[model samples]
Target: MPAKRTALIALLAGALYLVVGVTATDSLLPAGARGGDTTTTARTDTGLVRGTRTATHTVYQGIPYAGPPKGAHRWAAPRPVRPWAGVRDATRPGPLCPQVASAYADVASLEEDCLVLNVTTGASAAARGHAPVLVWIHGDGAVGGGAYFDARRLADRGLVVVTVNYRLGVFGGFSYPGLEGSGTFALQDQQAALRWVRRNAAAFGGDPGNVTVAGSSFGAAAISGHLTSPGARGLFHRAVLASGEGMMDMPAGAMGEGVPAYPHYTWRTGQESRDTGVEMTSSLGCAGPDPRRALRCLRALPVKKVLEVPDIMNAFQAFAYGNEVLPELPEAALGQGRFLRVPLMSGATLDEHRLFVGMAHDAIGSPFTAGQYARALVTAFGRDAETVGARYPVTAFPSPALAWSTVVTDRMWARGTYAQATAFGRRTPTYAYEFADRDAPMYLPLPGAFDFGAYHAGDTPYVFEDPDAQKYFTDAQVRLSDTITDYWAQFARTGTPNRPGLVRWPRFEPGGAVPHTQSLGPDRIGPVDYAGEHRLDFWRRLAGQGTSPAPRPTEGKEQMS
Candidate 1:
């Protein structure tokens, strides 16, 4: 790959890391709630587990929801945990799934026995019983785990919060020609965790039937898979997708040089995934004529050897469709309204691509020039390059980087998010939002003079309590955080975010007088012209005029970053 393309790939990978990867200042464990020493115990289906009780909430960590997926269980559907004979400690968190550390994130792990989950419920909610359940899935297809998020804040709002860890990278997503659970082991692990929730939520003071599945970035994309997966039906009553790629399509050169546009940015056909696996078999020293024997040899290899494969973990990041876990591509399923009829809330940040564009320039150690921006347009939009350039002139923005960021953010992220929100709104109650705190804190350790205005994953700290993040929040930002958490908890409780006192969020009516998309910011907290702000009309016209060529399949390596 060329230097530009390599830098772009690193930029994309760094974006993923910023979303869910652990920062140096991040705490691995949540702060203890007020008033300690009161122990609480919950009886899971397997056995009794003790937890720490505070005046505000009760937190249970490192609870096994499924049997360890090691040895013969590797690459197979998750199995039930063997019932324990005595009490199991639920204080510290379990190890994270296998993944290599990256330049942007500090997380690295090689543990395969990592199928664990954490539960937190408000003390008042536990006493009341039947509190609505919020099941959280952490972001990044290859990095991070459940314990990264602190659920104590959300739990305090009369909700039972459950954060889960599943397989990651090659350990969870690798597939072979004869693999029984080709391309879907991680997804299957998530389903198994949901099954565990269904059986044991009552013990944790949650209503099994009133469950809301929520995630951001890759985790949100996985929820999109579950929306259409037969195995996930009735497992969740509501869904929240923040910065999900359910309807995203990558433009040529948007990710890297020579990388063609993909209709489904986060999905792959089972055959394609299997072919990639076959290509890797030789690299793994397990080449053979028989598929079954090759798979056996591949499985017998140590986890370190699998991790050692170049780009192996990122190769399997895109979930394989046309398999049992996902019978069809999630983007296609979502477009045709073939998903379950559930209440939905979906949105993205105002400057989603700024993080990627800024990081790309930062990695290359040069400013994004106006000439480079023009070339990028031609590379991405093809015949519509001049038209796009004319619409978004360099003089219209503060810098070339912001201009390019706005272009991709509108054409790719905003367009996809708008389409998904309208699709869900047409079928079920939907709430759309735009995180518009332009001055949101720069939590990542990125050293640059770029203006990262409410960039990708910037809204994360508002939902999950991070002590490092909280220290940087201004008074207004702190209020915004409380309001956002309330909205989430209220939505999980009642199917809708509307309640007394806070700004009334209306349903997203595509044909209404104005499709209401709550603009979440410290200064402004009401509906904003989402489509107009993102210049979606120009993108819509460009689409109508046939700008780019038809989508083509790119190598899995190109899809990851």
Candidate 2:
């Protein structure tokens, strides 16, 4: 118990560093409410009462959906929070979940006790009737992200908006033999939040039955997981997966000692993976005199030291398949038609991997030369390296980096999105799109030396109104935001995303153009079949024969520092 408390303290301190750096209102309430800034108090099924105000239209801040996950509860399923006796002050933002990333921390105000959600609604909805609900789950590569996203603009468009903060980093995902009692605590947190909405959204002027779960990047991937998880079924009627897919697993299979993992053909038991996780922690410096004590010690360590450990950052290391919450891999389950048949909207950006590669290049001090770029592809492709390089030759591309980013992005995100639509569209309603807005502002602070292009995560601000990034958008971005908000609202109200004044987005049929897709940019909202043009034919060929091409690392292959 002491060990667990130590972990909690360490996590709290780390979260404090991130949250305290940016926000002035440290906790949920400010020292004093601004005079004349409209505020309304509402009660929930739980004991707690919260306050809402007109931040543009109507915004509800710091509403608790679950109890604080601290002490023994730290690694357990999220419990329902106790309601308050009177109107609780909620004019300030809540603490974000414990995480190491400073970017999300500064905005979310991270804390070990953080499990609150914010809501925004249109004034017209309160005057009229309950509005359709749009619950947004954030994406920060599954490590750090929360609902610091401002959704007032969308609420102003006649919809009820919700943004939630979930557990992140080790607090949310880490699983080991010593921690078997707490498997997939982060996912459990999400489930509890969704259930809370089902029971309590009506009080916030939202339709409990008409709910849409949407997200970008890791948030989108989480939506995919939620749509497939049994515990999450019926919580949300519709989903929007922006720049994320469930099929992009590292090595695409579960691994054990002496077992080489392969895509779609390997599976392992939870007990076995728990054993593997123990072994992993030991190698990653969790080797105290008492092995169990080591877990406690690691938890107590500084956040920077934890993130500095390279193994923790690896994608494959983050998500393991043994837990009851995620008993099976999303891709394998989807392949066997084991997912809930919910209507979905999924797609990618024009240059999804460009941002990642650009970060690598700037860190390494040089752009990837044509040959080195091909070599990197070969390195990733392994035995089938040569064939892969030939398929996406650097010479054929305008730049080696561009060619490499194109191939990686297609395989990791775009192709997988297409595959998800192709397979799921067979039995469910699906809408696919590619966010091609070149002028869309990169939401985070990008290095001036880096050229991330219209990369991954750029579409987030479009969904949530960002004050800083909005200034860069052309008039077209404004129109696209309205169109997207309307489409999303309509999807929540109905199973389909069809709305007036926009291009008619059709439902996915086998081998047919989905109408929901738009080539969003400076004034273009036309039918864009980029999936077809990219020769999904080539991608299919690679996947049908699971082998990576050989590496011919070119002169200036990029590398992360």
Candidate 3:
């Protein structure tokens, strides 16, 4: 974030505080509520609640869906939150799940008491009645993110919008010996939140049976995982996955370690996850010959002591098998038609890897040399290095840096996205998209040398009404936002993104060799050959021949939603 923009937001927030007679921090506050006068109270399964009334919707925040995962409950499946006695104040969003500090911390504070959810519905009761429900899960490498997204627009569009905060980092995903298949605490938290929605949607003026689980990046992978998790079955009827897919992962030893690490965001077995946790235990000097005793010693350490150690961030913390919750890898299960037959929407950005490589450029100066680009490719793609280079020659691109970003975009992001989308299409009604807005805003400025066009997470502001970023959108972009949100809300309501007045978005044909993926940008919504656009043929050839895939180095947002 730029200093000038930060100061401007601070000044505007201060002005809002004066106008509303309440201090406004970075949290998502209703646009125009003052002195608690909005009569935003409602009842829940657990207790009564009060929210803040805005022009468009009633906003409820800090609603717990599960018990706090702390101390003795650290690695356990989420227990139902105990009911509260009286009406609870819910005007402000809950704190974020504990995480290693990152950009998300700038907006929402961090706390262990973070297994909470937020709801947004029409300000008027009639407007909310029978509205479709949309539950959002956020993704940022599963390290940070929460429910700070402002969903008043979607709520006003006849939808009940629920955003969630789950466990993150090692706290939410760590597994050790004797705790087999228990590393997926974050996923468990999501299921509990979904169950809460199913039980409480009617109270929020939403249709309980018409629910959609939507997310991006890790959040996308998460909902996709839920499609295969027995515990999450029958909870949601529809799904949306953006900037993520069912088959995203890295080959072993691609990131310099014999053990797959950091960029590998896929399912592992219980023993594989336990092995990684043991590495953390050894790093903290809590290792013992008896693995179970070492696990106990690691658990005994203070949460602060554990979180403060920055090295734990690199450990793979995705869901593991060997338990009933997630019986197998979502991709493998999804491949074999083992997932729930829900209507699904999945996509990635046109330039998904720019966000990552732009950050990497911080260390490597602009205009990378051929050797540097090849070395980076070898690091990400391992054995497929030569084939990948032959396909995406550095001389063919404008620069070596451009060529590298293209490989990361194609091989790491687009490849998995294609595999996952077509896989889901094979089993259910599906919609695929490629966010192709080349001039999307750069939240974090890259040096002049990097062009991170339509990068990963770029479509988030379009999904949620962003007060800060929206201020800068051109008329064309605002119209694009309207189109995107309308499509999403329509999908939640009717298991499809198409409506009467909008351009037709054809559903993915289950067995099409290469289905048409809708291209979204300023005043444009048309189908494109997603397979060819991302060069999936090259990827399929590489994968079919048992060649290595690629990965990215870095991975943020305040609202992991």
**Number of the top lDDT candidate:** 1
Reference-based TM-score of each model: 0.93, 0.82, 0.87
The whole-model C-alpha lDDT of candidate 3 against the native structure comes to: 0.71
Candidate 3 lDDT trough over 10 residues, lowest sum: 552-561
TM-score of predicted structure 1: 0.93
Q: Model 1, range 11-95, lDDT digits (tens) per residue?
A: 3664566555346433555744334557778899999998878767788888998898887778889998999888898867778
Question: Candidates sorted by TM-score, descending order?
Answer: 1, 3, 2
Q: Give the per-residue lDDT digits (tens) of candidate 2, residues 315-429.
A: 2213445456666777777655567767778777887777656545542366667767645654566677688787877788777777777777766666677666665665567
TM-score, prediction 2: 0.82
Please provide, for model 3 over 1-561, each residue's C-alpha lDDT reduced to its tens digit, 9 standing for 90 to 100.
011112222222222212111112553564434664474777898899888776666888889989887776777788887889878989776776765533322332346778889888877643437779999887653344445577877886789999888887577778777775467888888899999999998888888898999987778888878888888867999999987745876543222223333333567677777777776656687877786676677767777777655445435446666677787777777666677887888899998766555545532354467888788767667788888899999999877767877886887788788877766765677899999987776544234556768877788888786665577789999999999999999999998899998889998764555577899989578988887887877887877743232221111100000
Candidate 1 clash total? 0
Residue 442 accuracy (lDDT) in model 1 = 76
lDDT: the better of candidates 1 and 2: 1
All predictions: root-mean-square deviation over Cα?
5.6, 9.1, 8.0
Q: In model 1, how large is the Cα lDDT of residue 342? A: 80
Per-candidate count of clashing residue pairs (backbone under 3 Å): 0, 25, 1
The lDDT of each candidate is 0.82, 0.62, 0.71
